[model samples]
Target: MKRGWCFLLLWLLTPAWALAAELTGVRSRADAGNVRLVLDLSAPVKYKIFSLKNPYRLVVDIESTHTSKALSMPTTGMVKSVRAGKQQGGDLRVVFDLSSQVTPTSFLLKPQGAAGDRLVLDLGASTTPVKATTRSAGHQPQSKPKPQRSVVTRSVRDQPQRSVVIVIDPGHGGVDPGARGKNGVREKDVVLGISKELARLINKQPGMRAVLTRSDDRFIELSARRRMASKQHADLFLSIHANSFTNSKVRGSAVYALSQKGASSAAARALADKENAADLLGGVDLRGKPDLIKSVLMDLSQNATQESSLALAEKVLNGLSGVNKIHRNHVQTAGFVVLKSTSVPSVLVETAFISNPGEEKVLGSKKGQRKLASAIFKGVQDFVELDMALRLANAPSRPEISYEVRPGDTLSQVAQRYQVSLSRLRSVNSLRGDRLLVGKKLRIPTVAGI
Candidate 1:
């Protein structure tokens, strides 16, 4: 981790003229099973709204506009708080913090008698059919302190660490279908299908395990994706995507590394521009971020990360060229949001062009998806093994043992039985609760060189 991470490369301020419309006022009305929020605008505009789960939130994004200072956000009728902000490229981002799951419907109304143009939103809890998978709102997970006991360990030499961890991100999901093809192929679905295959192959390797940013079709903000990768301290972050173009004739597989100097090619620039809008399409609040920006650390990390990214891009490109048509003989560069991990070396792979009719058919088929997955799996495994082989040569190999809990045994007792710290057991296995379920298998970590 780099020090002095106070500088964050975020959106810059826009000028006055760029702020096109004036947000005049906001009002609301309430009734049983329904609540309406009306925003008076100086002009009619285009807008979109989407709901996010795992802490239910409703987000609204409007066209070029400025927020109204006099606009009052009412917390009545299932609304928690309404936060409005200026987004990059002269757009207005409004986020409604919700108390529970609510179906949101928004539409524009023409100026009527005694009223200006209005963007009316209806958020009704009862009208929305709650899904079984919805996590309870404000449900805080409790982690009890484990009972303490003495833990003994057999003396051993330096222990080798765990396998190299990779984070795989299948771009755009849920409401954001990503780029769509004429044949009904969706970018989100295609990438996800390929990513799942890659994960299976990576896990089969001796020293590699892959963690997905999202295991299912769900929306995860670009910021949260990188945050998850950093939290895991992943060795690499690979984002799988399908390319698209308005022309519909362009088709090929390409690999990209991040570039602070802008895009290397016009197509790369356009694709990055489209992909960067994913947060907006997915209804993510731009203002949600860390408190401090670390400029010096960010710069240092970017330089190193880009270097490693370029190397992986080269290797991956080679593997991909054999399986698919090469978009560019050399790796390309772009500002991909999901590839912006400071600590992890990241690369974004454009498997093929979804906009191209012929390529779309190939990518949509299971055979095509598996071929792409196998190419990516081989590339990543080759690169990671070579990189870590020298480092692991001197370290003792870590052998994970699975222990099934018996009756009358606590998690602490299990840790003691394995001569490992309780925290180590939990961290390695991603345990949340201290409660032990008999016959549940727990992966025990070795203490020699952990």
Candidate 2:
């Protein structure tokens, strides 16, 4: 009689101990452009993550974990399908079968009020090519040919290749030193170093390639940069730059994407105007012509590509948050003329503010450059995984569900209701203004904000 009572008591007490487990830090995202998993735990908790060969399923096991809160599997942003349940002995496990490949950015958030220690995971897009800068001596800078290359090339039937082309634009080259610091660090030099380091890292990754607008100290026109990407059929474009201000106290890195309508932020429009004026300094003809119409259409196409750009920017931003101060919580979008390429997903990363004396010293150092490069590389890796996940999710069929605009549906409010950032809402809807008036309609992209 005593032995039977003791056994029942032990079994009941085991679950209570398991329920007390607290999750500490979580630090893993897709690495090596492959669908990988990373997890940082608070204690020596038993867990396993592995893929099964037969039907391509990944299983994750966690010992002694139970919750009244529902266990939600990763959704179809960067994931195809997911299922979670408790196995025998009351252990927690999750199984995922990807249609293609999936890279997950996962972390654990501690209990706040009602919730217990929770895990958060972000799914990212497929990997594209890394941005590279080419310094070929014989590479010719050509004028726009009379017979323009076809904008759309149908190559779906061709064999898939690993090599991906990327264009890297080092902002403020030549006479344009961009933002200057009293501490003797030039914004142009800082950005160049980071860009070179990033290029080196990207090139090291297999099936990736990068090109630079200006290889040396020479100046390259903004228009020429876009032309170069189009000529090479570049998959992605990234422009590296450093920020500066009158006050040296401001610090942190910022990522910028192209904005089609309203400025990504108040400061973005100013930067765009300054960058667009670079051609004036180089004495390029800006007079009215029929070719300019094509340029306008190209700008519209750039808007469409912002989706990919935002994915890249978010991954990079998430990585940078670990090392440096994040300038903005979310990726910033703006009317950057340099990012106005139709087919390519383009972004401008303000690595740090050069005006700060401490940051200036760090930017000039080799170690700082490498750190920045590594963070950026991680961001790129995350982007690739997420991109692949998205492709796999959408491969089968399009999702259904639409939203008709209601009165007082401000961009911020709609974004909040949908649990997305305001910038994303604007990007998808092509809203010209941040303040939405009554009677406008917008499409909700995802089933839910994953």
The lDDT values for all models are 0.71, 0.60
| lDDT for residue 312 in candidate 1, whole number 0-100 | 79
Candidate 1 wrong stretches, greater than 4 Å: 1-159, 285-302, 391-450
lDDT of 2 at 338: 67
Q: What is the lDDT of residue 223 in candidate 2?
A: 70
Residue 276 displacement in candidate 1 (angstroms): 1.1
Model 1: which ten-residue window has the lowest total lDDT? Answer: 148-157
Q: After superposition, how far is residue 278 of candidate 1 from its true place, in Å?
A: 0.6
Cα misplacement distance, residue 11 of candidate 2 (Å): 43
For model 2 the TM-score comes to 0.53
lDDT of 2 by residue, 1-450 (tens): 999999989878775545444233323344444333323333334444433322334445556554344433344433445555444455555556665433333333433455444343333342421111111112112332121112111111122333444567787778777777777888778777887788778767654566666655667777777776665456678888887777899888888887777677777777667666766666664434437535644644443466677777887888888889987889887777667754667788988888888788778888998898789878875555334332322333224225667875677766543334567677777877787656766665442221
Q: Candidate 1 at 321: error in angstroms?
A: 0.6
Question: TM-score of every model?
Answer: 0.53, 0.53
**Shift in Å, residue 413, candidate 1:** 24
